[model samples]
Target: MADREDKNAENVAGKFYVDSQCIDCDLCRETAPKNFTRADDEGYSFVYKQPESDEEREQCIEAMEGCPVEAIGNDGED
Candidate 1:
């Protein structure tokens, strides 16, 4: 599970986020490219955009569930 407190600062203000535990895996990015983006300096993936449609949200959720290190999170704050 991803901790809100430990989530990456680059993450956009939303329900979905990526934590510091990210291992720079491409799973999330591959799973939801629109919602997830790479941080070149840190070499990690973070949620850069919130899903607007159901399909997009589902894709984001899939990416979160598929995260190898469980770095992705959905706290439903947005």
Candidate 2:
């Protein structure tokens, strides 16, 4: 279980992270469609890519803030 968790974490690194508390609101996708997409099973937002440009980064930040459940965050401290 620990190894699986670690692998999952690694796969999602450098991208947007949705904590277990996510409510599947889809605000992140609405805010940053290019970088976030809805998961088919849960309808929760997941990162499509780690933003590289200033505009994309700003969009990600907005998505993080707009999340009703506060589910979205960068992989590490900002």
Candidate 3:
């Protein structure tokens, strides 16, 4: 599970975030390109935008579920 305390600083203030456990995988990026992005220097993924629509929300959820390291978290502000 992703630790909110350890969430990446690059992540915007939102429900979806990526923690330190992230392994630089492209899964979230591929699954939710609009909401998630790569921190090239850090080699980790972080949530850049909160979902603005049902489709975007679903995509973020899919990315969270597909994360192999369980680095994605959604228990945040709505």
Candidate 4:
């Protein structure tokens, strides 16, 4: 599970976040391009944007589910 304490600094303030456990696998990025993006310097992924629509929320959920390192987390915020 992703640890909020370890959440990537680049992640936007939101319910969803990516943590330092991320392995840069590109799964989240490919799964939810709008929300997840690469931190080129750190070689990890972070949530750059919060979902704005039902479809985007679904995509973010999918990305969270697909993260290989379990680095994605949903804090259940709206």
Candidate 5:
């Protein structure tokens, strides 16, 4: 059960959630395509996968750093 929960959370990916604070800047997608994607309807960015490679992990960290609104993080736990 705990493993399942962890998997579910990993599937959701990232520590950040796009909120009303998002400006649809697409920076996250640009920084990490494998991890972040644009939502079709909302045009906001979301994490598609937890980064597996060093490069990808760096990309996600960069996306978080580059967020204009600082909307990205470990779901505010950071």
Candidate 6:
């Protein structure tokens, strides 16, 4: 489970976030390109945007479901 307290600094202020447990995987980026991104220099992923539509929201959920380390969080404030 992702620790909100340890969420990545690059994540925007939103319900979706990536915590320090992220392993720099690209699955979230591939699954929700509009909402997730990577900082190659930092070797981590973060939520760059919040979902704006039902489809986007589902995609973000999929990304979180597919995450191997459960680094993605969707319960934070918007």
Query: Which 10 residues in a row give candidate 6 its minimum summed lDDT?
Result: 69-78
- Comparing 1 with 2 on lDDT, the higher-scoring candidate is 1
Off by over 4 Å in 6: none
Q: What TM-scores do the predictions have?
A: 0.96, 0.73, 0.96, 0.96, 0.70, 0.95
Candidate 6 C-alpha error for residue 8, in Å: 0.4
lDDT of 4 by residue, 10-54 (tens): 999989999999999999889899889999999999999999999
Clashing pairs in 3: none
Candidate 6 clash pair list: none
lDDT of 6 by residue, 4-46 (tens): 8899999999899999999987999999999999998999999
- The lDDT of each candidate is 0.92, 0.65, 0.93, 0.93, 0.62, 0.92
As for TM-score, the candidate ahead, 1 or 5, is 1
Mind sharing the TM-score for model 1? Answer: 0.96
Error of 5 at 66 (Å): 0.8
Off by over 4 Å in 5: 1-17, 75-78
Candidate 1 per-residue C-alpha lDDT over 1-78 given as tens digits, one digit per residue, 9 for 90 to 100: 999999999999989999999999799899889899999998999988999889889999999899988999999897
Model 6: what TM-score? 0.95
Q: Which regions of candidate 1 fall more than 4 Å away from where they truly are?
A: none
The residue-by-residue lDDT of candidate 3 on 1-78, one tens digit each, is 989999999989978899999998799999999999999998999999999999999999999999999999988598
